[model samples]
Target: MSQRYPHPSEPAPEPDSALLGVLAAVIVALIGGVVYGVVGGTFHVEISWAAVALGFFTGYVSGKAGGANPVLQAAAAVFSIGGVYLGELVIAALITSQDLNIALTEVFLSHSGLVGETWDLLFRDKFTVLFFALGAAGAVAGVRKGGAR
Candidate 1:
């Protein structure tokens, strides 16, 4: 059997770095959080499933960028949690904005205490805790799957 050689014109693939993975995960977390918030706010209901997507995407991106590292996995999990929290805050801000007839940005920036309080109330739901756990699990699973590449 003859072994095939790579084309001379093709460049070698770069090695993944943990730093890159963490950075990518952070970016994904922020974007995912915003998207989750927007979707929940638009429908006037909190969609728990989006948290899973956010976690999975964050982990997948991190693993793909940084390879199979424990640090990356941990970072993915942490970021996923933060992302969910951020989404809740955004949702609260959006609801407040609509009810108070204020801008979303204004509510977020100027009335953070109100948003925080609302988030706390929302977080008290048992479903929220369950979804948060599911999101963390999804993130870890995604990291393992993506890192296998």
Candidate 2:
């Protein structure tokens, strides 16, 4: 069988923008964080594996929107960490809301100090640290696998 290739006269596709990749990563991280939070809060259980999935989705979206680059990979890693942190914070807020019989937004926004303290306590766990590292690794792997070369 003969191999087919692009014509010599055809122009190469334009490279994706770094800004777009960053934006996509940020958006994915925020959404994934909320989802992680809702699942943990509703079930009153902490599923650490969700962190890895969140990181993978964030990196995959960023990589698909932007070409493979060192800066994008680094950004994906950082965003993954941020996503995990946000998830923890959200979980704290949700639990507080349930305990205090308050709205979730009120607990999250009005009781920032309490939420911060709870988040800190939760974040100090050894398993949380291990999962965080795993999340970062998943993000980098996703970027490498999904990005355009």
Candidate 3:
């Protein structure tokens, strides 16, 4: 057997720390949430592609960074779903307040229950509920496909 190259077997790259992965996913989720809110609100889109993309991106980031840890996977799903829902609530508030000429802060701060009401209203639709489940499933799929562990 002759040597074909200088280094035939290089070590695999180490996986990122779980903490770092989770943190990165969270940061990405925050940005995704903002984008989702803006686009969904502006166009009055109930079944927005942005929301699905956000979930997938969040899971992919977490999986690639964390290497398929159970906690990371679960967190990714939870955070992604929450992020999408939160985005919807924020957008609803912004639009309602803008239409009424009321400060967004005043509506949010003065009426915290409004958030729950908004959630109820938005999720009342069967399609919206289905989308949420789909979003979570997308997150898990992303994690499984992208993660090594």
Candidate 4:
């Protein structure tokens, strides 16, 4: 059952599907990040724009593959952010030099010779996770109700 005169905003399917695609992109990014972190270590260049691109592309592709409604297809561009986080870890692991760079700040945390805990926060993986989550939210929201034209 398809609509012959589909509105620019309306797809043959529904909006929920679009939302789901966004969610899947985030999940994929998380998994990719985990894999890369476990194998490659945590040194990564920040290509946030790439993540956004991936999020949109993956979401769009996935939605199309699933035969999602057109409305959902638009969401695909937003949902693809999932690939960003996941790709980040995997990319980091694959590209890192496998050296001490990963925890440079942390390694020197204690030997500050009475220095402040500047390095302590540097070693945390918490930021990566948080960023990934943000990416997911941004990508998903961007697709579903993004202010994009």
User: How many pairs of residues collide in each model?
Assistant: 0, 0, 0, 14
Q: Give one digit per residue, the lDDT tens place, for model 4 in 8-80.
A: 9774543344455546545654554454334433344544444554444454444533334445444443334
- RMSD of each candidate? 4.2, 4.7, 4.3, 9.9
Kindly report which residue stretches of model 3 are placed more than 4 angstroms away from their true locations once superposed: 1-9
The stretch of ten residues in a row with the least summed lDDT in candidate 2 is: 116-125
Provide the lowest-lDDT 10-residue window in model 4. Answer: 114-123
**Deviation from native of the Cα of residue 44 in model 1, angstroms:** 2.5
> Would you estimate the TM-scores of all the predictions?
0.87, 0.86, 0.78, 0.37
How accurate locally, in lDDT, is each candidate? Answer: 0.83, 0.82, 0.74, 0.44
- Model 3 lDDT per residue over 65-137, tens place: 8886777777877888877877777777766666667887886898657755765765558777666776677
Number of the top lDDT candidate? 1
Ranking by TM-score: 1, 2, 3, 4
Model 3: lDDT of residue 135: 64
Local accuracy of candidate 2 as per-residue lDDT tens digits, 64-141: 888786677889889988888788888888887888899988886789888888777766688888778877887887
Tens digits of per-residue lDDT for model 1, 28-111: 989998998888878766676798999999999889988887788888988988888788778888888898899988997899
Query: Could you arrange the candidates by lDDT from highest to lowest?
Result: 1, 2, 3, 4
Stretches > 4 Å off in candidate 4:
1-44, 67-82, 95-126, 141-149
How many clashing pairs does model 1 include? Answer: 0
